[model samples]
Target: MNPSRPAPLTRVDGSPVRVLVVDDEANLSDLLRMALQNEGWDARTAANGQEALNLVREFAPDLVVLDIMMPGIDGMEVLRRLRSTGNDVPVLFLTAKDAVEDRIAGISAGGDDYLTKPFNLEEVVVRLRGMARRHVAAAAAAETRLRVGDLTLDEETYEVVRGGIPIKLTAKEFDLLRYLMQNQRRVLSRSQILDQVWSYDFGGTSSVVEIYISYLRKKIDSLGEALIHTVRGVGYTIKSAE
Candidate 1:
């Protein structure tokens, strides 16, 4: 374990994150299991595809660190079976197959991310942490609507309302406002907003960000208690007064 590597999360909820490491190599499986346990997770190991599937049913892990090549029922097949049954558990593939096509195949077959063999332990830990974070965030984002005090944004209908009044916004303004609301209370710099709202190739300046932010404020904050706030010289943050 590298000293400078980021630490794994303590847990998502009250219980530690559960991980199932599936690989035919006992040494590799053992190493990963020990490492994950050290990171304060409930880590289990599966020697082959059959064992991996069994654990998938029994352990119901939060993450599956799987291998591609195995003697029987291979990693890809196991993943396919899991997906076929509507299991969307996050999986990180550990494989020697580093080619682009192999990666595509793994991803197309439902792997979340892949790490080539001879991987750095720190890299594995970082990827696992990132995957965990994304899994948690995505689950939260699947909500149909978001509310902050009197303001409400419906994801399915693309509607915004404040204090029982409907608010209309342009497509760009809606996107920007949605981003801000999703990450409510987190100050987002102009560059970050541009990248997310306008995408990476918008070729716009910071002034554009300022203009749209003002537009959102007028629509969203004009009627009700202000939710959009500017952190002078830093960026913008949105939080409900309630």
Candidate 2:
């Protein structure tokens, strides 16, 4: 018995980053599978559109390399169906047709990228890596929720909870709090806060900065140790009371 081949390399989230090569050409798929395996990535092949769909469902691919010229449920339709279902998994299309319209149609249909036929294997690999990196970055950024100890803020929902209790804030306050949490331990000057949260030049008195900071402290720090603090002459900072 021979030793089983090791699994592909994983993305930052620990699960393997799977790539699907969808092409009717067995030789090309075979070459890609071997090349991707050498890159420490999991790779699979599909001979047609229907099989590609089935594999996408089962494989939950991190990226897909699709052939535009496949017979039957062609690559364009495959992309349409995928997008219709709101599956935004990144796809790179391979096309022998160099028509500008075809590339435009593929992109407008939802393809993330495309490679003209006879593309260098190295270029294919580079494009795939670029696509995969983008997906990972988007996934990481989709983390709408930020937390520190008992305090939590949801960027998408504009909600805040601390110590298992919901806290309400005005829009300005929420924006200010979000900025503070984003910066964490970094002290921020009034001018800095005014520029970022207020998004304008106040021109003179920074009393607005002081007022909002006080408001945040009252609402956020009243029930617990201070999470927001004045840094004397420097500015202000947020950290756990401990």
Candidate 3:
């Protein structure tokens, strides 16, 4: 890794960040994919707007490099549809058009950034790094304080509360609960939990996930409507109590 290069941003689940490159130009899309992978992101490519939309749903990319002009369903319409569906994934528009009006139109269509064709590769990486920084900052501000039903967890202060009552937890237990709350309502397998919450040096097996979960349940679920649930043969999920 280059010492000066910004560290790769990770998904909320602590997995590698995913990026989608959309373009009709196969060579350009391939180049961008290779560059992003070099940055340690999981990158995919789509050759048209429709394919891009399909991949957005299936891959759930953290960012998209979208081309403005395509044969069917142009990038503008794709972005419009995405925003309509409340998918606010950051979009960087690529266009051969360099007119002032064209740039304005792309930005107005909810593009987070714009780049013209024949741009420098390093410049693209720098712009993406800037966008990634802003995205992480915004998410950090929002997720520093998390809430689900009457339960709350503060990442910065390491606090957990339920129904207006403060709940005490050990460091490991707090980490487990924070991970669960971060992915509220999403079923998380034991392996996933182990990867995110435990260090590589941890000598325990997958059973440790269950042990920490049980500790959290005694502190959190025992107090109220049971925010944590076990999905038979799958794993666990946490959600707002109904």
Candidate 4:
């Protein structure tokens, strides 16, 4: 990773965020990988949920772009298992099912966000990046007195703590956490976050959002309570877990 490269606003390592794309559609996975990589993320792919889980343990991705309708070990089941293992990695569900119930079910099942099929790749990238940013911020803020839920963020020394346990975060992670806490509980659009936190015009990709959200999940949700929620057909919000 280039030291000069602008680290993800939400990662502690200041390195390119890592992502796992889980879909049975080879073509879709390839396209997503290319798009994510274009944004400087370490993007990888899996053909199914089981394969995705294997990669998750190995790659330890910051976020997962999961297809809800895979052939085996569908996205919902995969999420269930991940939660069962106490893995709070942020997940953005991609599905052909746009029914309101389906969307609700996804959120109720612990998904950080959801995207419908026939979606624009750029939008997907944007939303994902938004997620990643919030997560990174939460993780980085774990140090000092800043607290989101039971998680605490310390701006003075750049530390993080959750449930009274100390958590370490990178510089970028601290910045991201501060941003979210500064605007806690607000529904922030991807474009808005990119403009404010990224400090540059995204020019078309949204994968950065996903990457950071994944980072946050690793830090915050790893303990079980999901503070971030996706508003289908809209954007993301950081709130006290309901």
- Reference-based lDDT, each prediction: 0.88, 0.88, 0.89, 0.83
Native-referenced Cα lDDT, model 2? 0.88
Clashing residue pairs in candidate 3 are none
Assess every candidate by TM-score. Answer: 0.55, 0.59, 0.65, 0.58
Model 2 bad stretches (over 4 Å)? 1-9, 144-242
TM-score of 2: 0.59
lDDT of 4 by residue, 99-170 (tens): 999999999999999999989999999998998897777766553465668877766866777887777766
Model 2 clash pairs are none
Best by lDDT, which number? 3
lDDT of 2 at 39: 70
Please identify which of the two predictions, 1 or 2, would achieve the higher TM-score against the true structure: 2
Candidate 2 shows a clash count of 0
| lDDT score of residue 182 within candidate 2 | 89
Give lDDT: candidate 1, residue 220: 78
Top TM-score hit: 3
RMSD of 4: 18.3
User: Candidate 1 has which clashing residue pairs, if any?
Assistant: none
